[model samples]
Target: MASKERKTPLIRVKNLYKVFGPNAGKVLQQVKEGKSKDDILAETGHTVGLSDINMDIYPGEIFVVMGLSGSGKSTLIRHFNRLIDPTAGVIEVEGSDVMSFDDKALQQFRRHKMSMVFQRFGLMPHRSVLDNIGYGLQIQGVAKQEREKLARYWLETVGLDGYDKHFPANLSGGQQQRVGLARALCTDADILLMDEAFSALDPLIRSEMQDQLIELQEKLHKTIVFITHDLDEALRLGDRIAILRDGVLVQQGEPVDILLHPADDYVEAFVKDVNRARALTVETVMKPQVCRISAETIGEALAEMRKSKDDYGYYINEDGYQGVITQETLEGVEQSEYDKAIDPSLLDSVPAVHTDALLEAVIPETLDSEHPLPVINADGDVEGRLSRSTLAEVLSDQAGSEEDDEKVKKLKTSKSLAA
Candidate 1:
């Protein structure tokens, strides 16, 4: 989801390269000169973990890094808190160079600025859930009573309140994972680095955890860097996705941009089977196709609406959510309501959907409201109007396509049997 605001990046990486072997620094220049990972490994026995990687991660957004195993996604995330130092490059957080931190600065940074949730739910089997959650704060020298109180708040926040006395061994996998999540939150860090955090959960549990992350993000708005090999998970959680292949960044952009316009065959194939209705944002299905017009340009906006044959449009201005206008309201009960902003007196306000919100969210908003929904961006400025008919068409078409694909597969199997 693209926000219109020009907020400064919380983290920035420039010309980042990582080499796994002992001769990493020597081979780093070869990588920068466009050498392949395989070539670098074959010649000098140096494994290229990342090559010329540059990215900007904004505050209060989930930035997902994904690739198949060996793509170096995990390696890239490690360098954020200097878990794995880069062979060469600049790593900056809030304008401070991460690579320059001394041991004490690094330890404090890891304790107060960043926390990681591991794939295997790294928990202390001997420690109770409450103690485990408070482990981070305890390390920071917080008093036992105060740390427990904060831990208890996060435990309840993650819906594990009554299980405080339980040990990691006594809980199910999902419960243990939730405890890990609670522990991370209890630290109250500014950034969270989750490396395949929910990859080990069963499908239902995975979905539940994903929902928890999304719901929590709505209120917490912490800057999160998530890693996964699963494309579906990437689509569901990423505010912007960066894809890697063989230690190189193949593509990086908003999920909708990745879906509607892949940068290459690799990205295209990755998204080929995705369910658009589920992954698509409200902006894609919003009326008139084009979006983000000004309130003063009601004439052009109205013309575009008529061209697309939609009844409603939003009169968006810099201040945001000005009003919604209908065709009848715009026609003005007279000659063409010529080139001017629609009368604010004739407009009505309705519930708004952020342009980055999934189309699935639009259905409920539409059901609860009588008028077409207003679509907005991060700054709460009106971006477009999402119509009920448009959302239905998107969902219906996807469902129909899947049904047809299943029927065709069945028919092919029947023919094989007859032969």
Candidate 2:
């Protein structure tokens, strides 16, 4: 993670507001007074496109803006490129105010500083694959040979090799979108603005495109502002997500944080259907475990267990977590053998889960094992232990919270009726 103080933000939007229709500025007072979107529209004949939206986008992060239709997700991304003017507030890119830019400066910014990939795969039907990919560079006045060279490289990078001579009309929807991605990438801009880039594709193809984008991001690390209406897509791709509702900023945070702690009922409703078992990692539910050494005798291991008050403990070595040791093994050993190293054959063969492993994967391993599941880091060192009880407890807490929220709502309604 980049230090906030040391690293400057790539993009910053503050108290941004956009309203459509004439005299849109006149509706600001109504918005400040907490009037609803529908009320403002009925009285003022203006539609609120965005409301007091503020967020900082860090470099090399995929920042996702998502909402249902008319939620202003598409409207919000347009502010980044100054494609749509905000009725109020600040939009700064790299410390410069984008709203203050002259036409010439704005043109330069769009041409060189950033690129957009539209949902429609905005490729000219008359242009060949190579021509479409090289279009951006050509517009920048690069020589024909040089532009084609860069275009061909990105074409192969996007897995569209040997299709350079083909036209957009000849390609499938997925392939056409790849051309659009290649074109934007060909510009080599520091920032990318993707507006529902994969929403038009079929389910399987959309998933494949998402994987491709993730793979490309690992290598390129460009700062991206992706717009989407799909919750699954946002969770899969967003480094940080900002959800909008009726032009208002609802919540914004890492996917895991948003999943674990929704800010309000609206945000909770959005995440309620998510597969928590598959979404949460082992680290979320793991507990600290008492560790024992492989060379230790049964008596020594038993002593450690008694001290920790744990029924069993894990045997660890320099290489990594070995297996589980039980109280029975410690007690069954002969008096003479009690001081010897615990037998490896008698080890419980506990299954280990990586820190990044989802709880869904941990379920089967823990169901049959008597000992707590060992959670290991990438390097195979045991970090903590997870048990079925702990898993159930975390899940129950989530369900209980929802139930509690319903109770609160009912109480509020009852009080209102009494009053």
Candidate 3:
């Protein structure tokens, strides 16, 4: 018989609980025995830091925990590397239960398998930038010369080249954050826990740091759990966002899906002000259909568009489909005394996007460009035209569909009970 395959999560938290109070231990004992939330609350009068939290973080995924203050986002992330002990739960990393590890084992796990960056730049005040970055390696007993070399490499990675001799006090907020990031990454830790690493920076520096994180993630692909209170920051950087409210996981998914179809009123309120049109893209809205164009008269082009019931007409060329002329283009057209500069290359103005790109990623270019963008296949062939209204309608319909589904589910449950 083939052995049963066990799919191990990179990081797993099962029935995690953390309570803060004099009777916290007793309350957590009740929680472990599967007591009701109210019973556990009443028994210990303990504040639940994290309540029965369950999550599986995949390898190489940027998993973000988002919540307001005191929502347990930081508490949950800390439980992963055992920076803070959970009152009740099994925390697993690489198929090993970290919560079960002895002090020596836990220390080795943190030193080798994980690294953390905090909101405050935790660099040593007396140490040089290089020493601060390599501090983790030094703790692990790496040779001084080797640790220095690794620190230099990390400084370059974080775009802090030629600042190896400077102390933490000499750096700006952004530079300090970069040093913090470099220090965390210098360990080459398989798992990274970042607790609001950019929260202390100015708005401009925060945005810049976010961009740097994106760039670094692309290159390193380390499994990361980032905690942040800013939804926009979560949306900008997370591969998947886990939203928390009052120590409960409200919802979790990709940014576009969450924005377009929130799970409840809480989520909707969070996303209400977002520009759906700008957040969604041509690829998200475009229908997959055979789009054809004629190499004949403008009348033939118009006829083809009318026949296809398409808003735009694709212009075919010997090389391939060259450009698209929409009704808007034709409406904007004017006759000129001088022969219009009809560069055949005008067709290239149409922006093309891959199917995998999030609608939000494609919107800014389309909205800012002179011409409408075409949805393209992997081969760069025109798939469909994406207009502003089309993208807007898609978002509206998606939101409506989610609401409709919820109503349908409720009705079914009510009917079942009535019967």
Give the best candidate by lDDT. Answer: 2
Higher-scoring candidate on lDDT, 1 or 2: 2
Q: Write the per-residue lDDT of candidate 3 for residues 134-183, one digit (tens) a residue.
A: 99999999999999999999999889999999999999989998999999
Candidate 2 or 3, higher TM-score?
2
- Candidate 3: where are CA atoms >4 Å away? 1-8, 29-43, 277-286, 289-321, 324-372, 377-385, 394-419
Off by over 4 Å in 2: 1-8, 284-303, 331-339, 394-419
Show the colliding residue pairs in model 1. Answer: none
Off by over 4 Å in 1: 1-4, 285-357, 360-419
| lDDT of each residue in 114-181, candidate 2, tens digit only | 99999999999999999999999998999999999999999999999999999999999999999999
Q: Mind sharing the TM-score for model 1?
A: 0.76
Using TM-score as the measure, name the better of candidate 1 and candidate 3.
1
Q: Assess each prediction's global lDDT (C-alpha) against the native.
A: 0.82, 0.84, 0.75
Candidate 1 on 74-105: residue-level lDDT in tens? 99999999999988899999999999999999
Residue-pair clashes per candidate = 0, 0, 3
